[model samples]
Target: GPYVIPSETPRGEKYLSRIKLSWSTMATTASCPPPSVLLPIRTTTAGARLTSSHGSRAGHAVTTTGGAAHARPPLPMGMARALLPQRAPLLRRLLMAGALAASCTCFLLVLQAQASVPPRYDGFAYGVGAAAWKDAVLVEAFLDPLCPDSRDAWHPLRLAVERYSPMVSLIVHPFPLPYHTYSYHACRALHIANKLNSSSTYPLLELFFKNQGKFSNRATSSISSTAVTGEISKMAAQAVGNSVSEFQSGFSDMRSDMAARVSFKYGCTRGVAGAPFFFVNGFLQPGGGSPIDFSTWTSILEPLVAHHGQTIEMLTSV
Candidate 1:
C-alpha cells in the first residue's frame, strides 16, 4: 500500500514519511472495514477545528479552516479510523512509543557530534627530524618564540635530541601566543627561515629565544608589522647565510603565513592552548605545559630509549 500522509480529522492528524503498508485481501472482504485515505493536512493558528478537503490519492490539497497557519506539527496519532476497532488501540500505542524512542535517539546523536574532538596533526614539516624512523618516537612541541617558559624547555629538548637522535625526534610547531604581540612575527620568521634552510629553522628559533627580551620590548614599542618583518627578514638572511634580497622574497611570500596558520591549527586540535606544550608519541606529556626540569625530561626519555633496546650511554657516546 502507498504511504499515508497526515489527515485532519475530528480526533487529530497522522503523518508518515515514505511508508509502505501491507494490505490483506481480507481488507477488501465484506467483513473488513473501508481503508481510510490519509491526506496531508494544514492547521490554523486561531485554535479552529481541523478542516480537510482531499481524496486518498496524491496531488490533492488539504487546507486548514479559517486560513490560519500551523504552529507545530504533532506526531502521528492513533491508527486510521477505518481500521478494525480492536486493532486501532494497540497500533496507536506502538506508534507513540516509536516516536518517543526516535526523539531520544536524535538527542543522543546531537550530543555526540558536539563532544567530538577536532582532527589532529598527521603531516610532516615545521620540525627538525626525520619524517619517519622505525626506532624513533615522534614528539611535537608547541612554542611561542617570545615566551620564557618556551625558552626554558628548549635547552633540555635540544640536549635530549642530541642524545636520542635516531631513537627520538621533535617536531617544532610555532604556536605564537596571543598575549605575546611580537611572538607571531617571530614564528613567521622561523617559517620563512625554514624555507630558506631547513637546518636553519631551529637555529633561528634559538636566536629568538635567547633574545626574547629585545623582541618583547620592540614588539611593545609601537613598531609596525612591516618594520618587524623587515627586521626579521634581515636576521633570517644572516641565520641561513642567504643574500638579504633572497631571504626577503621568501619571507614576504604568502606561504610564510600559510605555514604559521597550519601549525597553529594543528596545535589547536591537539589541545595546545599555550606555549611549551609537548606531546611524545602523540600523547601529551605530564606537566608538559609548564617548565619541566632537565632531570624530569631525562627520566621520561630514559625508559623509552631502554624499551627500544638503546641505552642512554650508547646514544650519548654516538
Candidate 2:
C-alpha cells in the first residue's frame, strides 16, 4: 500500500513537503549544507572577501567597498531539523532563501550523505523530559496549551496518567500551534514549571485552557504583545510551581521549538488530520474520544498495545 500523508501538512502539497515530512518516518536526516555559512569560506583573507575552500584554494574574489557584516544573522530556529536524506533538499532550499545578500555569486551546497534523524519523541517535550510512564500504555499528549479541546481532554488524561502511572507514561507535550500566538507560550510555561521536576502539568494545562477562550477564535491570530502572552504563560506555568524566568526561558528555548516541530511533523506523517490527536504506539487514536467514551480508547487500544513493540519496530523499517 502507498504511504499516506495528512492533508493539514505542508508536506502533502508537493514533493518537498512530502520528502521533509518523511524524514523521521524513514529514520534519516536529509542531506544539505548548513544554513549559517560563508559562501566561499576562505581562511586567508585580509579584508571583506571570498574564499571557496580551505588552503586558500584558487577561487573567485569580490572586494567589498563598504563595511562587512560583523556576524552572520542567525538561521531561523526551526531550520536545522533532522529529516530523511532523500527529502531534505527542499528544506535546505527554503532556508537558503533567507540568506540573500547584495553579494552576487552562485551558491552551491555540497550535501554529505549522513543519515541520522534524531530519535525525537514528541508530545509535551519541554523544560525537562516528561514524567516516566508506568505499566499501562502511555498516551503522551503533544497538546497545544492554548487549545480549548486540549484543556477539556487534559483533565481525563491527567486522571488516566495518575491512576495508571504505573502502567502508562502520560507525557504532556504542549506544543505551539502555528496559528495561535499563545499556544507556544502556554506550552513553554508548562515546560518552565517542570523545572522543579514535580509540578502538576494538569493544573498548568487547565489554567491555560480556561483563559484560552479570551485569546481568539481565528487560527492565525497573535496574542497582541509578547508581554501579555508572556504574562499568561508565566501565570499558567506557575500554577504547577514553575518560576517566571525559568518558565520564560524554557518557553523560548530553541530545542523546545525543534521538539514541537518534530512532533507536528510526526503528527502529519502519522495521519494526524487534526488536533487532540492521539498516537498510541504507532497507531492513531481519535482526539479526546472516538464515537464513544473510555471504551473507545480501550477497545481500540488494548489489542494494539498488546502487540505494539514488535509492530512499531517493524513499521520503523518500512
Candidate 3:
C-alpha cells in the first residue's frame, strides 16, 4: 500500500514532501510505522505538533520552528509503541541516577552540619579564678535549681570542685526542667545573685537546692508566681547580704530573664536532656546525669588533674 497525502494545496504538498523525506531518513535508523500508516504532523506559526496516528493517545511531541525539539512523549502501551523511538529506558535511567546523587549530597550536608562541638560560656563559672585557668579541666554541670537530682548532686560536685582548686574549673548552667513549675524563676534568681555578687552565686544556688521542696509543684500549686518569686528574692537577698528590694528589682529585670534563657539554650545545644547532666573537658560524662558519690567524682577528676599537671609541666619545659 502507498501513503496518501491529505490535501492538494501547495502547503499540503510541502508537508507531504517533508514527511516523505523524514520518513525515508528515519525508517533506516529509527522505529516508525509502516508506509500505509499516517503520522499526524501539523505546522503552525508557533511550532510543529506531532501526534501518534494509530489510535494512541499516549502523549504529544512538540517542535519549534527553529528545529529545536522539546521532551518527547511516552509511546503507546502495546503494538502502537513502535510508532515512536524507544527512548524511555535511557531517560528513566538518567533521571534515577540524578535523584540518587541528589539524595546522597543532601545526606552528607546534614552530617557535616551536625558535626560540631558545643560552645562554652565562661560567665557561668563559679569559684575564684574559675575562668582564669586556661589549661585546667573544664567541668560544666547543667542543673535545674528545683530538681531533686540536681540538689543531690550539688554537694559532691561542690566538694570535687573545691578539692581540685585551681586545677579544675566548674561552670554551673541553669537548665530548668519543664515539669518543675518554678525552676525558671529559681534559676532567674540565681542569675540575679550572680550579677550582684559573683561570690554569692554558689551560696544562692546551694540555698535554692536545700529549699527546693518549698517551691515544688505541690507546694506552690495554690500560690501565685509573684508570691513564689518574692519569697525566692528574699531568700536570695538574705543569702547574698543584699536588700530584699534590690533583689526584687533585679528579679523583675528583663536582663536576668535573658541571662537565664541564654544558659538554658546553651544547655540545649549541648544536648542536655535532664538536670545534673555533666560535661568534662567538653565531653559528656556517662552516668553524670544522676547523683554520683564523692568517690566517683574523685575517680573521674584524679586522672584529668594528673593529665593537666603533666601538660603544664611539659609546656613550661618547652
The prediction achieving the highest TM-score against the true structure is: 3
- Expressed as tens digits, the lDDT of each residue in 1-318 for candidate 1 is 333233344332322111212222444453342222334434354332323444433333446665644333332233333333545477889999999999999999867744333254422333334655434776677888889999998888878766777677777788888888878778878877776777788788888888787678555588776777677777777788898778767656787776777777677777888879988887898775687667877888888877766454678789
List lDDT for all candidates, in order.
0.67, 0.51, 0.78
Model 2 gets an lDDT of 0.51
Q: Compared with the true structure, what per-residue lDDT tens digits does model 3 show for residues 70-123?
A: 544554454366655567598889999999999999999877755233344534
Query: What tens digits encode model 2's per-residue C-alpha lDDT throughout 180-277?
Result: 66565555555455544435655666676777766654532544556665676566555755556666666567765555555555555555544566
State residue 65's C-alpha deviation in candidate 3, in Å. Answer: 59
Give the top-scoring candidate (lDDT). Answer: 3
**Once superposed on the true structure, which residue ranges of model 2 sit more than 4 Å away at CA?**
1-116, 124-136, 161-165, 196-198, 217-223, 240-243, 249-253, 286-292, 298-318
TM-score of each: 0.57, 0.47, 0.63
Q: Count the backbone clashes (under 3 Å) in each candidate.
A: 0, 15, 0
Better of 1 and 2 by lDDT: 1
Residue 193, candidate 3: alpha-carbon lDDT:
88
